[model samples]
Target: MRDHGIAHIVETILDAPENMTAVNEIKERAWQAGFKAGYNECLTHVNPLFKSGFTDERSGFHGIDIEAVYAAAVDAYNNLSISAIEDIEKCLEAEDYVDRLRLLFDRPGEEDEAAGDAKNDAGTSGTKVD
Candidate 1:
């Protein structure tokens, strides 16, 4: 049996130009989705107050610093985006491991036939016979 490691699988994937393009596209989309989610969450918490001009005359003085809010939103967006990309990378690595393990253990063309033979020999209850 040959050893097919996760690194080998990853290297095979990365070596293909098309796969590299696809991977880049996937990471870009993940980053965009994370940024949108983070920005939307920040808006949910701050949009109402800011929409009303950040002041309520009846309730004394109220203010929201636009620069500070923008900075915070950017920071949150960056953090979320990075985390999303990392998660995507981790999933890809895990998939590579699975692929490597499958390649290492799965014999082509014989597995299905062997399984069928075993099932037929064992009967429905799966008891082995001598």
Candidate 2:
């Protein structure tokens, strides 16, 4: 099986399901970062999927399943060569960065105690997209 081109975009979109106003900007950041990391070819494949406004709805539009897509993308990403994995990791890391930015912006001047708990979780605070 081949890796779907929408890995990074799917990752970002899944993180901010409530606020989509910044969706395009978030996607752009993810793509540019992925491209620099040598995943532009991959992004090209995913570009068309998001162009038709499938995400205009909060349900991500009828029949659009992000969880499945993300799983396929990540599985495919992991099977790529070491260098490709590194590039994908860079894009994934960028996604993480942007997500943190969103959280920071939402909270503004206040800090939530759960934030501290999440950070201190000894269970590794594992990243599971599925």
Candidate 3:
């Protein structure tokens, strides 16, 4: 039947390896973009927090430990960056066409169910529910 042939063509196009690859590439690029955006946003807030200050002590006038401060700032930045990336990744995974396609092809395994449980435990979207 013509309808069957059309359905076959649609299925072929959807299941094509090249199409899957392209979709994966697009998802990766989107994730990278989200990471960059989150990093930049965090940087904007963190840059001003790193400042040198002078301290008056009984011994003598001394400047704040620049090295220590820098180290702490770097640690905070790294932590913040990681948190931001995770949040963004969660948001991406929660609602995306790439994940939809993946779910379509890949049957729900135990790991998948666990991940779904985790997602449910964390609430639906990345944004605050309240």
Candidate 4:
């Protein structure tokens, strides 16, 4: 995503509390805003393609569905990765993302065991994806 730069974060913290923790919090929020801004920019660029109704359901359903899933995955990944810790959030996000994919691809009545398996796997790894 687009990096709005540390300058903005610095300016923000400079006007706020002088505590280091507050500074860090401001920096984190700035990082998140920058990330979201970039994502929104992407969506703005792509919106025109879908707005014209040129894509019929039978022909474009799969592509549109996949794009939606990808957007959701990106949002989940962004939120999970905010702490920059590759240990906990990374694993949780992966498990949840996989579970969602399974839910989407599996037949309606076939998801019972797969979800259980995912939860068990994530639990054994020290994180509950549910």
The local lDDT score (0 to 100) that residue 39 gets in candidate 1 is 56
Clashes of each: 0, 0, 0, 0
Which scores greater on TM-score, model 2 or model 4? 4
lDDT of 2 by residue, 10-123 (tens): 554345433342344445455544434343344455568666422323332235444454455555544434433344466456535433433423333444333224432532
Residue 55 lDDT in candidate 4: 27
- True-vs-predicted CA distance for residue 108, candidate 2, Å: 45
Ranking by TM-score: 3, 1, 4, 2
Model 3 lDDT vs. the true structure? Answer: 0.43
- Tens-digit lDDT track for model 3 on 78-102? 4433332343355445545233433
Candidate 2, residue 58: the lDDT equals: 32
Point out where model 1 deviates above 4 Å: 1-10, 51-130
Candidate 4, residues 1-130, lDDT tens digits: the string is 0122134334433443334444455455555555555555656666796774332333323234444444554555445422322322343466454344333333444324433344424423323545
Against the reference, the lDDT scores of all candidates come to 0.44, 0.41, 0.43, 0.42
* Superposition TM-score, candidate 4 onto the true structure: 0.25
Candidate that would win on TM-score: 3
Candidate numbers sorted by lDDT from highest down: 1, 3, 4, 2
Q: By TM-score, how accurate is candidate 3?
A: 0.35
Which pairs of residues clash in candidate 3, taking residues 3 or more apart in a chain or in different chains?
Answer: none
Error of 4 at 40 (Å): 0.9
lDDT of 1 at 53: 40
Cα RMSDs, all models = 15.4, 20.0, 19.9, 22.2
